[model samples]
Each structure stands twice: as structure tokens, then as C-alpha cells.
Target: MVNGDDNNARITNGNLAEVGQFPYQAGLNVSFGNSSTTWCGGTLISHRWIVTAAHCLDGAESVHVYLGATNISDVTEPGQRHFIVDQSGIIVHANWTKSTVTNDISLIKLPRLIAYSQTIRAAILPRLVNGSYSLYEQQTAYASGWGRDSDSSDSVSPVLRYVAMPVMPHILCRMYWSGAVSEKMICMSTSSGKSTCHGDSGGPLVYRDGNSSYLIGTTSFGTSMGCEVGFPAVFTRITSYLEWIREHIPDLP
Candidate 1:
């Protein structure tokens, strides 16, 4: 993946997603004050709230959100819904540090509540274990987005894509990122030529526990060198911000 404010993170070496495959996936077309448009990914945590990376909202004048669509451009796609939000509805974390990409999470409030269907729904939040969020090192998780298909690609994918990655140990992640990897972040093991490339920022890292899938992480950043360079991709650990999230969106489901 690329920088948080850069529209480069994407699902490199991933598979095309089917309709209703990622009901919680949200495609964002963020427009800046200068009229430049950038792409980003988001997760629907509730009918009225969308969770994404704070950097995605940097200088964002407006956000065009597309839900329930495999092809973001297909407005007539079955169950597709669209909504527009401005800065008034956006909320960036107070502690978000753009320099280090720390606490790179944010929430977007929809103008109106959306009805849930088979193709549109909220993602499940993770449950705490022993008063702390559970960590799942070595476990597999899925990341979906409409970001770039490759590091060299300038355009993001029109259709949704996803990849399966394994969770790596925090210590191992720290070894790669050094002190840059904080306890508030989660890392996914990377393979050669396989990663979340540019345009994948703010997407969900979902883990399946039993029959339920929980949102574990939000795409933050990958190595500046490139997404497929074997360094673990860092994410804003969703579990680490459960309290913060609940405080903002008290009715989270």
C-alpha cells in the first residue's frame, strides 16, 4: 500500500469479488477542495456510520459512497445504493497523527439511515476477550477493496477485489517496522507480489471466528517502497479503538 493520503493502496494479486460477497464494503470517491478526486475503501459499521481511514478524509471536500455494488460505476447494479457526505458529517480521530499514521481511523455519518438487505449490511464488530481485544496471530483474514490492482497502476479497479492474508505476530511486525509499529496497529504477513496496493486504504481486514466474521483492522499503510515487497502491511487495529468507536457511535452493531 502507499501513503494514507495517497490514492495508491489496492488489492494486489487478489480475486474478483461477487455480488453480496462483501456487503459491508464501501467504495469512496473523495473529492478535495482543489477538485481532485481520490479513491478509497470503507466499511459500513452501521446503517448511518461508515468507518474508514482518517487520511482518506484529509482535505476531502465531499465523499461519494457506493454500497452493495461489485462494479462501483454501475449505478443500476442490483441493490446498489449511493450517498453523498460532506465535512460536517465526517469525524476524524482526535489523536490521529498524520506524520506517523497513528490512529488512522475515522467515521462518516450518512445523511439518512440505509435499509439493510442481502447485498447491503453492516460488518460485525469484534468481541473483547478477558477485557481486552483478542489477537489472532497466524490466523487468516480477508481484505476487500476497489483500490489499484498493482503498484504501477495509476487507476483503481472499478470492480471489487479481495485477498486472503495471514496475521503475523506483533513482535515480528515490530522487527520489520521497528518502533514504528505500535500496539494500536495490526500487521498482516506479506508475500512476494501479493499485497494491498495503493487505493486499498481504509478497507476492512475481516477475520472469521466460528460462523461470524469480525472486522479486525482498517487498512493504514504498506511499505513506501511498494505493497509487494514482503514487508507486512500495517493496519489500524479495530479492536484497539472499540471504546473510541462506541463513544462516537454509541449504537454500533
Candidate 2:
């Protein structure tokens, strides 16, 4: 599986994103040195770093990152920039556990600094309240990726797609997922068949606070049942790893 069947990824029942709509979005092609390639999404947090899911780098070797392009296949897209990175640049969280899906965040270093443009920019990370996240339940957040459009699809979407989903209370999500839910995770659920599926792992879940958008979550996992089954889509809470992120990307703005 590209994004792995074990970990949920992608956007189902989403709208095709316009060029430049999500300037911080990044499409990743991961190669495992055996001609095996998988896809994942990421967010540009700074000119030299991208934040993504640790699972996305599991058993991976190299990554080809595409920035500022909705269409991954189009190399000629005006604002798009491509960079190839080896495993040396991939940084998975020290406590990341694949079995429990805990601490599922990672940071990738760009080989060189990138210039920001209208179609290429970094996202704002949330400001912690007393060293922790403030509840934003009931607020609408947007998830964007180039993952599969449906559960049955074997390939990833050709264009970037996004869906608007409302954040669910942690208590409610815990009730649904039982012990699988953790404080380091955030969740969103919808009844309209809008959710992440395979190939969207490591993608961004953005929350707009006032006039600025915050990179609140990174695509983690969803129910094993399916994407549209009224289950909550889980993400690695960015707010919970601020200090970890700062430790890695010291120049983070």
C-alpha cells in the first residue's frame, strides 16, 4: 500500500484544491530502495523544514518533495519546486511508536532553503496555552492532500484535494476509539463521507484562527473499518510537540 493500509490516509468526498490555495501543502513520494514508492502529504513549516507523520517515513529511504503544485505529475507548474532528500534528513520523533500510533510526528530537512511566494509559503503553528493546547472542539478545520479519493482506489489522487471537517471533543473521540485515543492526538469526524484515506498520511490538518491558519494536526490514522464510516480521523496534535519541534527546527518562526 502506498500510504499503508495499516495507517489511514487521503481525502474522500473532497473538493479539488485550486493552485496556490494551500501554499504550505507538500506532496511527498517516498522510496524504500527497492523500487517501492509510497505517497504521503506534508506541511512546510519553514524554508528548510517540513512537518509530517513519522509513519510516513517508516521503512522509507528517500523522499522527493513537491511544493507549490496541486498536480504532482506536472513538473512544469510555475511555482512548484522539487527536492530530493535521503534518509539522513528524515527525523522521526524519539518516542514515536508504530504499535500504538503514539508520537507520530516527524520533521524533514530541506537540502536548501526555499523562497516563499504566493504559491509557496509556510504555515503557522499554534501557540501553546500554559505549555499545552487549548481545546478547539466544534471549530472547523481543513485537511488537504493528494491521497486516494476513495477507499477502493489503488492509486493516489492526481490533484490536491481538501475537505472541511469539524473538530470533535477528545472525550467523544475517546469513547469511539477507546484506549487507542491519546492526549497527543486530535480528531475530526463528519457524517457526510468526508475523511482521510490511504495516501494522505502526514498531510496537514489546518485550523483557521481569526485571519491566520494554524497547522494544528498531521494525518495519522482513521478507523480500520473505513474512511466514511462515521469514525473519527485521528491526527498527531502539533501543539503537543511544540518543544520537540523547536528542538529540531531551531529557526522555526
Candidate 3:
């Protein structure tokens, strides 16, 4: 009730994300009655910037980026595990459309710079990657969030969870989604049955290159069959939005 939406859910067939393992993970919370609730996930791309799904920002009220927590439920407890702050600026993609979901990404700016620590860090952008491995088809990538653990369940998990899924060809993904799999998107899934659900929206789809993690996509949407199904879940491709990202985060390297 304190961290996640009771009506929607997150990662399915995934394991818990240990403390500090995903320092860039964040929860996008909004006022719900007398309390706040996290309904979506996001990635900290810089000290003062976070990237999330455009749909998560549109039409939402009193929204804030909740970060520094591996387990968001701890916020509800007497002790603190996360930090919540109002966004200083928000940039929803100019091309974003609710009907087609063409540009389903947004940039959120914080008022102050976040101090770096084990549980809080910035993500590497795909353009800045100079690593041994660049993302490619069939390569494994990871997604982490605290959405529901089951597709049919309405309860959202309080613990951070993650799934390692393989990136697939857009053509292969088009087989499942038809016209919905746009060039601005990338698809990920596995025969092992790992995927994301509703509450996982706006979370980063990360690729590991050596010790650093690069953000390649942002959670967008999935099939109607739900998260547990082998259906390829589509994400907003980060690489395609580099120019837009730099337009907002001008100092980004």
C-alpha cells in the first residue's frame, strides 16, 4: 500500500533484486487518497535526471520519483528506505501518442543533485557505451521492478524483482504484436517464461557490459495474455531517442 499499486502488478518469474544491485531503479509514486502509491518504475540516468514511460507521466497527479530503495515497502515502516521528491521538470516526447504509443518515453528532472552511494547511482546510456559487448540480437538483458509476481494477481510486490530476458529480432517480435511493434521499440522475452507486467511500466531494460549497466530500453507495454506468458514485451528503445535525451539532459556525456 505504501510503495506499489494494489490493483496492478510487476516482474513475473523473476528473482528479488538485492540491495544495491540495481542502484538506478526508482518508483514513480503519486498521491492516492491520504497516502502515496508507486504505480510505475523508472531509471536514474543522471544525478538529476530520470527516464520513464511517457504514459506514466501523462494525466498523473502529484507524481514524484521515489528512489534509493531496493525494497520500497520499507518506506511505510518506521525507518526509511527511499527518498521522494517532486520533479522540477518533465519532458514528454513530442511524438508520444496514447493511441499508437509511438514515442513512449519521458525525462524527469530533479530539483537537487542526488548524492551517490551504494544504493543510488546513475545509469550508462547506450550512446556512451565503450564496452566489450554492445547489445545485439539474442543477447540477454535485464529488467527490474516491484510489480506483481503473478500476472493474474492484483497484489503488487514490495520487494524489487528482476528477470533476465533475451533481446530478439524486431521481425520476430512483429510476429507476435503485428503493427504495434514500432521501430522506436525493442522486444525482449524468453522461452523460460520471464516477462514484465503492468506495474513494471517505465522501468529500465538494462544490459550489462562488464561491471557497468547500460540502459537500452524503457518498459512500454505487453500482450493481453499478461506477464507470465512468453509473449514478447515491447520497450521504448533508448538508442533511438539519443537526440531527444540529449536535448533534455544537455550536459550528458
Measured against the true structure, the TM-scores of the candidates, in listed sequence, are 0.95, 0.95, 0.87
lDDT of 3 by residue, 1-253 (tens): 0122211336887898777888899887754444645588899998888899887776454565677777776765322234444433767788888767679898887767878788888889985447433445788899988788886667668888999979988888877876667777998974566788768889989988799898999988876656666778788899889889998788986
- Stretches of candidate 1 above 4 Å error? 1-8
Give lDDT for model 3.
Answer: 0.77
Question: Model 2: which residue pairs collide?
Answer: 9-197, 9-198, 10-197, 10-200
Instruction: Give the alpha carbon lDDT tens digit for every residue of 83-112 in model 2.
Output: 999999999888888888899999899999
For model 3, what is the error of residue 194's alpha carbon versus the real structure, in angstroms, after optimal superposition? Answer: 1.4
> After aligning candidate 3 to the native by TM-score, how far in Å is the CA of 18 from where it should be?
0.8
> What lDDT does each candidate get?
0.86, 0.88, 0.77
> Residue 93 of model 1: what lDDT?
92
Off by over 4 Å in 3: 1-9, 31-38, 76-88, 128-135
Question: Number of the top candidate by lDDT?
Answer: 2
Q: What's the CA RMSD of model 2 in angstroms?
A: 2.2
CA shift at 74, candidate 2, in angstroms? 1.6
lDDT of 3 at 100: 71
lDDT at 54, model 2: 93
